[model samples]
Target chain A: NAGVTQTPKFRVLKTGQSMTLLCAQDMNHEYMYWYRQDPGMGLRLIHYSVGEGTTAKGEVPDGYNVSRLKKQNFLLGLESAAPSQTSVYFCASSPRGGVGQPQHFGDGTRLSIL
Target chain B: GESVGLHLPTLSVQEGDNSIINCAYSNSASDYFIWYKQESGKGPQFIIDIRSNMDKRQGQRVTVLLNKTVKHLSLQIAATQPGDSAVYFCAENGASGGSNYKLTFGKGTLLTVNP
Candidate 1:
């Protein structure tokens, strides 16, 4: 199985540019999440989706938006990228169970804004 | 603001030695904790997890101990090897709200095993 996969492994954007990151999972998980990993800052949640057609803002959702139109895919969009938004983005998924279940993660997408 | 944090930012061990990584959390209501290992250019991989009701849990070569009273968590690697070199993170769930799906992750501890 492919598990979780993220596209556009690396990208460079100018200030105010827009882009989208794609995450796909074959595990058929019921929950998906978007997180950004910054140096010495751990992973901060950007957005999440509990099920298809449902999305919720996470800890740091000011510059991002997410959509879970399909059960297997979650999309993260940066409407106007900023230098502060440059970070490695990770995607994760878990089974229907609550916090007890472990999450599976994708390699991640590295984005740099100048 | 309450957050999960690691006691040390880096650790180095000799081959065949035991390695211990420590974490501290301020949220008293956290009921579930997890340890993740991340290699260079990769995502965090689940190592093991323990619930607040339990004090300790063990996997193949790793053990996780949780001390809720002190708000402390630890991950112990039995045998340090080159493959064990990576950044280790601790995450907590059930911190706030009725949602149990959200987790607070620590900054991470880098473990290096030298031959």
Candidate 2:
């Protein structure tokens, strides 16, 4: 069904390199989010989008950026990759915003910074 | 800025045995709670959810119990199978101000099922 899809499943970059991770959902969801998971830690919110043209900062929004130009597509970018930024990035979507809604997640992208 | 956390980091169980994972949340204002299971190299999948007002909820072989008195949440699997091996996380969140949509998650507990 292609509920939520992420591209470039794995990537390795130098300390100062930059890259973009793409996420797309086919359920026509209105809310999308990006989170990073580290060892022995819970998933930390990086950035999120409420609609096609809206975005907001999350708990751990530092060192990352996100954009939602279309209803189904959400993009996460790293202006300058840091070693501390290496983690498993996950993207999720829901029918709408808020804590009451159920969120569906993509497989996730494994990013490594040298 | 409160958080949710698990008491145990890992739980090992034999096949056909029941599994119980516990979580504790620090926020009394949070009313919604959810459980997610994440396997290796994959995303977290929704297993079940419980609200603060409800004491228990069931789904398939899984059941979620919420104790508002102690701010504790637990997930019980009737008969955990090998497929049930994964990292389970409990998440809690609240909604207010017309736009605060945040879901705080716990550091997952890894469930190991022995065949």
Candidate 3:
């Protein structure tokens, strides 16, 4: 299984440019998340989806939007990229919700806004 | 806002020595905590987890200790190896409805195991 896979391992955008990062999980997990990792700052949640057709805001959802049109896919979009948004983005997925289920993560997408 | 923080930003240990990383969380309502290790240019990988009901949980050579009374958590690796070198993060699950199960991560501790 692919577990979790994120597209565009690297990207560079100018301020005000827009782009979308795609995350796909073959595990059929119910929970999927988007996080941004900045230097000296831990991974901050950007957005999340409990299941297909359901999306919710996370800790750092500003400057981003998400969609879960399909159970296996979660998309994070930057309407207008900013330098502050330049960071490594990670996608993760967890099986059915319980305290024991561990989250599996994708490699990551390194984004740089110029 | 919920916050999780690590006691140190970096740690160095000999290959055969035991390593311990400490974390402090501000959210008392957080019932679940997790430890993740992230290698360079990669995402965090789950190591171990503990619930508020339990004080300790062990997995392989890794152990997680939770002290709810003090809102502190720790990850211990016995007989650390060079492969253990990575950035470790401690995360706590919030209590809010929508974001209750969501994880809030600490800055992370860079563990460098010397051979």
Q: What overall lDDT goes with each candidate model?
A: 0.90, 0.88, 0.88
Q: If ranked by lDDT, best first, what sequence of candidates would result?
A: 1, 2, 3
Candidate 2, position B62, lDDT: 97
- Residue range B1-115, candidate 1, lDDT tens digits: 1236533388889999999998889888888899999999999999999988899999999999888888888999998899999999988886477687798888888899999
How does model 3 do on interface RMSD, in angstroms? 2.1
- Over A1-114, each residue of candidate 2 has an lDDT whose tens digit, in order, gives 989999989999999999999999999999999999988788889998989999999989988989899999999999999999999999999888665687889999999999
Comparison by DockQ, 1 against 2, better one: 1
Model 1 lDDT per residue over A1-114, tens place: 899999999999999999999999999899999999988688999999989999999999998999999999999999999999999999999986355877889999999999
- Candidate 3's C-alpha runs over 4 A off are B1-3, B6-8
TM-score of each: 0.95, 0.95, 0.93
lDDT of 3 at A114: 100
Model 3: lDDT of residue B32: 86
The residue-level lDDT of candidate 1 at B102 comes to 90
Would candidate 1 be rated incorrect, acceptable, medium or high by CAPRI criteria?
medium
lDDT of 2 by residue, B1-115 (tens): 1126433388999999999988888778887888999999999999988777789999999999988888888999998999999988888875445554678889888899999
Native contacts retained, all candidates in order = 0.59, 0.57, 0.55
